[model samples]
Target: MSLLFVLAFLVGPPAVLLTVIGPPIRGWPTTDQLRAWLQQPLTEETLTAGLAIGAWLIWLLVAYTVAVRIIIRLRATTAWLRRMPLPTPLQATASGMAGAAVFGITTNTVTTTPPEPPQPVATGTAAFHDETAPKDHRDPAAREDGVTVAGGWLPWEVAEQVTAAAALVWLRRRRDYQPHPTHPDDTDLTPLPPTVTAVQAALADAPTTPPSDRTAALLEALPIGGLGLTGPGALSVGRGLLVTAVLAGQRHSPTTLIVTRATLVLLLGPAGETLGRRLPLTIVDTVDEAAQPLQPAGPAAEEFSPGQRPDEPSSGPNHQTIVLLNEHDGDEEQLTRLAATGTATAALVVVLGERPDGPNWHANSTGHLHDPHHPNMPTPRLCVLDQTAATDLLTVIASPDPAPPGLASERPPLPNAGPPKLSLPRQVARREPPHLSTPPRQRLHLRVLGDPQLLIDGEPLTIRRSAGLQVLVYLAIHPNGADTAQLTDAIWPGLPRHSLTGRLYTALSELRSTIRTASDLPVVNHSDDRYRLNPAHIDVDLWQLHATIHQAAANLTHTTTAWQAVLNAYTADLATTRTWPWLDPHREATRRRIIDLCAALAEKEPDPHRALQLLQDGIRIDPYNAELHRQVSWASTELQPWDRLTNNHG
Candidate 1:
């Protein structure tokens, strides 16, 4: 009701008042009156009475009602157009205009007519069949001559309507029509593959409704791997179209984009700068360069390189959302992981030109530009983008801020081809380029004995962050994963949740990455709260050491070899760094287990010399333990007789 009042009072009056005010100024309607209703020559009294605010307002209300009815009629006409067969372009246009005009003139254009009386049946129809009447009565020529009606050309509307009705009846009869199946040998019957651009264009211009410019909503509503952009990277026009689509998508967000193709980033960097946007893009130009960040960097560099580019300055921007722009060799696995991880972390991927073996929004100029390796596959959701869209996207890439920096555009690395695919069992097998492909996942070797050390393929692996290693160690100790809150408390205590959350992800990524480098298997997995190490491929020495001790203790008849294995498993005190008070319980438990094993072995051994040796070793580990000291004294006493007898014999 309130909206009605606003529109009725505010909107209606201005348009109506223009008529009364316009005549005296520029002079329209030529005759000083609005219609033929004026009684005498135009005068102030007459004009004032006719143009009274209430009277004019009433007229406007009537016009509004008429307009509503006209709109309904127009909608009906549009419906009719959809069902009707195509007419000549000239006739179609003319009919459309005429229909709309008639509909506007009055709302009651549609009417029902009474059925016409049935034509009289032929006289003596039974006699004619029995040959009782004239035989000519049965002939068609004779029956038509009885009326002798002269025919005339039908009106255009009647003719068109009859023809349309006939066509509709014919169409309905064949509504279930299907094309005949082709012969097996008929190669010509094979379907032609549709290009991505053609498919997308059809979608863009589909006539069900008007095209929407709600591009922002379209982007956010997309599911992971639900959208992609493909075009000839060689064509500048195609490049612009893709770049535009990406920037336009990010317009409503601050999400990271992990671009795998360098050519795309190269095109985007300058375009972004030109558009006044300064995107937070990280360039991993090569595979070797990509892993370098996973490995250790300088202390200062490592400190500042969490969830960001390492080369970035300390005070420079460290954005949460970044674009990974490059299709580096052997990045198929990395990109796949990135797509999933980024999505989990609120990052989005936009593929340019390259056809990733996944479903997404594909934008391409032609089908030929598609990846030859995936020749038979089709990109159903692909859309065609033109130069205009590209230009608009460039504008969108620029930052909304008024001021932009004066930095030179950074050129990105060109894409390098990996080893060719070889067909195996109807699937193309791809090989990664040597430098770009990270090692396949295998069993991990973790040493948490004295100082934490990581070994990959028997070589000392460099660690980038201590926190990540700590997370691994903590998870290793805890077979079941810990929640983020518990991990934060254990790994990065006393830190704010927001700050710690990002750091935790960064650390986790680094750890998982290094684990992949040394051992192809991911060492850790997290769902909601808990993050756990996979027991299958990860071998933690501390875990093994405990197992060894249990097996040795459980054996009823212990062998010297069993005791030796237990001792071998324990290289040093549990975890050398003793800064954490949390380690106290584990440290105490391990020490006590070793002492008990040594003492038990000493008492059970038959050799007095070996017994002395076991007791002394136990004493070395725990000199203050009274039982070990006593055992050592007893062993020495037992050996005294043997020493005296040996001297007497000599």
Candidate 2:
């Protein structure tokens, strides 16, 4: 207070002196004159000067306080960044320089042109002071085109550059850093192994808004569904095909989820990019839409354009799916209708919004969508054998056939197995041959020559007994199928009719259940006392082998690749643990045909060595078959005409 009083007295006197703009007084003023001046009302010049000085001082005090606070905060922020688990940004310098360069280029501030005389240099380079140039002198055309005025350096330009550099460093660190997976013990993520952990960390780093400056890690982590589910291998359709293959043993027509248009846009292009653009996703809106049957009137999936990124690849027509945007009502009648009828050809996948308002389509298991409203929900997103949650209820239906505590088999044991010792020979569970490289999504892949095995999605099934497996094989061979009596006679020829019926029923039931669990489809279908594999759900290698061999035999237009494919198909004989007696007859017939076909192929082949190779392959498949050995011997004995002629000349 004392210092301020002294300073105020000195400052006021000087300021008052300056306002009395006149010749300096030669002598001290008289006491009476000074008293008279003080007594009179203060002049406007003196009052104005006093107010200006006081205002300036107040502003100085406020500015100093703010600067102190800012410095304190900056130090704290630096410490926080240093302690973060992610790196503190090696790319900050490069990023800042790039950004500044872009800004300068856009504003016409970065140039080689020299500034006016008395030019000051920054960093030893001639500094270009753009402010001196008149607004009209700068490219008037470009200025009109929304180019912001870059009139040299602003008071805080340097500070702004420093702050921006800091921000960019933090952003890069966050984008690239993968948080340790919190829910490592999640059951759904178990099958994914290391891929699950990686994908989870990526999802954590990807901000829901997906800023333009997001690092490469975030961009790579973005889901393919964001590319608008077009072309071959679109995640929605690919997963749908995988589902179809699992359920029906075929990836024919895909299943599609009619997404509301607003939600659909988030998965695609730049709605998220445009600042201040809020997607119209709300709980109330969804509830209102899901209540009624969706007519899907807004726009077909055609409204969706290809991905905006130049590097993103365009997919094919097969990947083009029509999901109706903004079409559902609160009751979720669209999904309910789809689930009830099962008539819709394509499966539905909810890509962008909250789960359907109603309970009809509740089982979702699929990918990470950038939901704008709940940008930072901290929960572990999970998928079964994949990266995202599945939206299909049918997917959950694939849950392992209900295992109860100390569970017993539903059907009784096969009647023929002798007593307590030979009762349940539990070796029928089939696992895929380690050699075949098929993905889990492919249903019903078979490998039978060395060890007869049935694989559903690369996982093998084991039938409890050889007889039950034989029944499945027999049914596979004859598509038209067999009557109960025929199957009974085939399995138990001398047994009584009643006993055969009991045993057959038990075996058939167990086999059906096994196929259902493995392929998610019924392999054996019984109708009007006749049994056969459900035509739509079976893919036997034996069938392929027969077709390929026949194709080779009918070489009306022959090609080397085709013959090679034929020989490849016939490389192995049928069934290793020959349980079914019925297969032997057909197996023999097929082997003879393949041997004859191979011999014919060899006869037609131009190269004697290739022909010998084919003959050798044929012998290897059926070594003991006299005809195959005989054909091999004949092929070996027969010599080319050139060799015969050379011998005669000798």
Candidate 3:
């Protein structure tokens, strides 16, 4: 359409000007004059010449028309013929012929025009329009005829070029403006692992609103949703606020809690206050207040009256001493001093920041805390805190009121004297389960592991640091472990075959060294040109999760306890850093398993409550799953109150 418009606009005027002015300007002899001149010559020769010219013109017209038809047919057939494999020679010939024909047709179409019929005129009078007279404005037919006659012989080359250019422009514009299909609300756009998607979905469906409105909507409606906001400070604050808000709203508390870092508190406090007022919520700034009570001061006398002391010495330690250390600052001295004081009835050590070096304290300690050599040994009460954590130790301390018998009071007074004697055996006397023997003193051991960009296992691992972690995760997922070639292909499918082995070796070596350093466990074993994680030494969540899932699957027909087992199995993304192409199938398989397990639980559970929970969980994990929606509808129907059910179904 555009091409035609451009050609008409540019070429039409030039052709008209040339046709109207050429004869008068050049004073060329008219066709009549030429004919008269020829007639005066030898009659037979002139007549033969005229007939030959006319015949050639007729032949040109016939050939041009035939070429145009052939070109049009070829254009229409090209799409259908493309599916068939043509011989090289034939293809080339066909292409050349089509091109030539198209060119010829275009050239002829632009150049050819019928000659005008002769008009009668008074003798010796100029055939010019009287401009001063009123024009025959109402006669459009006459006007069009006059315009066509005025146009001179249009050049074939120019007209063809203009037409081609316009067509090309039109095609480009059409392509640019092509409309993409609208995405359905049910489509999942998450590029991450299914586990991440599941977690996001679960959070979305929970009664509490998400931290951000945009994120909440995305989580509820879209397949995947998240914020790229980095930094421990922001995450801690955001998470705390979200959790608090959800909890508070569920409890229908008038008070609102804003848990955040000091810097954020400064920035967002006023905004929070304003929001609270508008929403009729109370906002409490918990950043600075959280750390105040956790900090240790000099020991002082017990504040409680003498009679308040537990009867019979409680047959155990009077109070549990928790040694809290900021690992990021390498400040273990404070923790050690607190542990040595012997004042704590039972010590609860909290390590903030990275894991400490080995021989870890638990390994070397002579007191009760010791490593049992089991992969799943009771991870100590050690709470590792990052600088950004919004956890108020005081709040955790205060949360469980009516403190356990002999446990320290929430407001225990600091001791008055210098640090107490550090007699190891004496400390054992005060420990609970009096028969418990003092084990070997272990160094303060903490394995700083997991993805740093994301908090896993209470510590963050940088992307560079997470590569080895990811490798361990991959091996853990593979029940039999992967061979060199398999591992190489999984990790680096795009690499050249020759380089795969080298890259695999490098990754394996680095991974082993990292795991050894982080866990102080001999996790990797090399034998028969393949590497595998030592199941006995490594405590892998993935292994436990898979086992639980399998166990649950076996008992599907019996009971709905399998639902809880399946939920417990899912903890975090399969692997954080490594993007192994081969793992996609495994990841997808696990996702389907989760979906199936949840669906089965929803269907089998006799209690509508359990069924509803299962259905909701399944929906959160697989929002796009048609089965999930069906299950939710069924569960909701079964669980609805009698009155609401009657109204709804009716």
lDDT, residue 531, model 3: 69
Residues 1-650, model 2: lDDT tens digits: 96586567546655654566432334676898678768874878546656766755665576577669779889868845643332124344545656676666678854685332332222221121221112221111111111011111111111122223322322332222211111111121111212212222122212222121211112122221222222222333333322222222112133223344343333222331121022112122352343233333333333234543211222322222323332233335654443222112212223222224321111123323232333463221112222132221122323232335542222212222221111111112223434546653345755555467777767788876555766877665565778888877555432346646877777778777877666676667788889876545557776666666655656624636766787677656667445233444445545555555555556556666676786687666556544445555655666466478778999
- Can you give the lDDT of residue 154 in candidate 3? 11
535 Cα displacement, candidate 2 (Å):
3.3
Better of 2 and 3 by TM-score: 2
Model 3 over residues 1-650: C-alpha lDDT tens digits?
Answer: 86586557555544544464322134566999678877686577456556555654565566577669779888757834642333345446656766676666767766665344234332321122212111211121122111000111111121122222222322332222211111111112122322222222212212221122211111111001011112233323232223233323323332223222332333234343332333222232332232333334334223223553211112222221212223332335533343323222222222322223211223111111233333353322111122222122112111122325643212211112121111110110111222437852212111211231222244543324223444565666664666777665444332345645765566667755654455455656778867676655444555556566556645645446666776766744344332333443454444555655565444445566766777678667545555456556655665568447668889
Residue 310 accuracy (lDDT) in model 2: 18
Q: Quick one: RMSD of model 1?
A: 35.7
In candidate 3, what residue range of length 10 has the lowest lDDT sum?
A: 145-154
The lDDT per prediction is 0.46, 0.41, 0.37
Off by over 4 Å in 3: 1-467, 518-520, 554-562, 576-580, 638-650
lDDT of 3 at 607: 61
Global Cα RMSD, each model: 35.7, 36.9, 39.8
The numbered model that scores best in lDDT is: 1
TM-score for model 1? 0.31
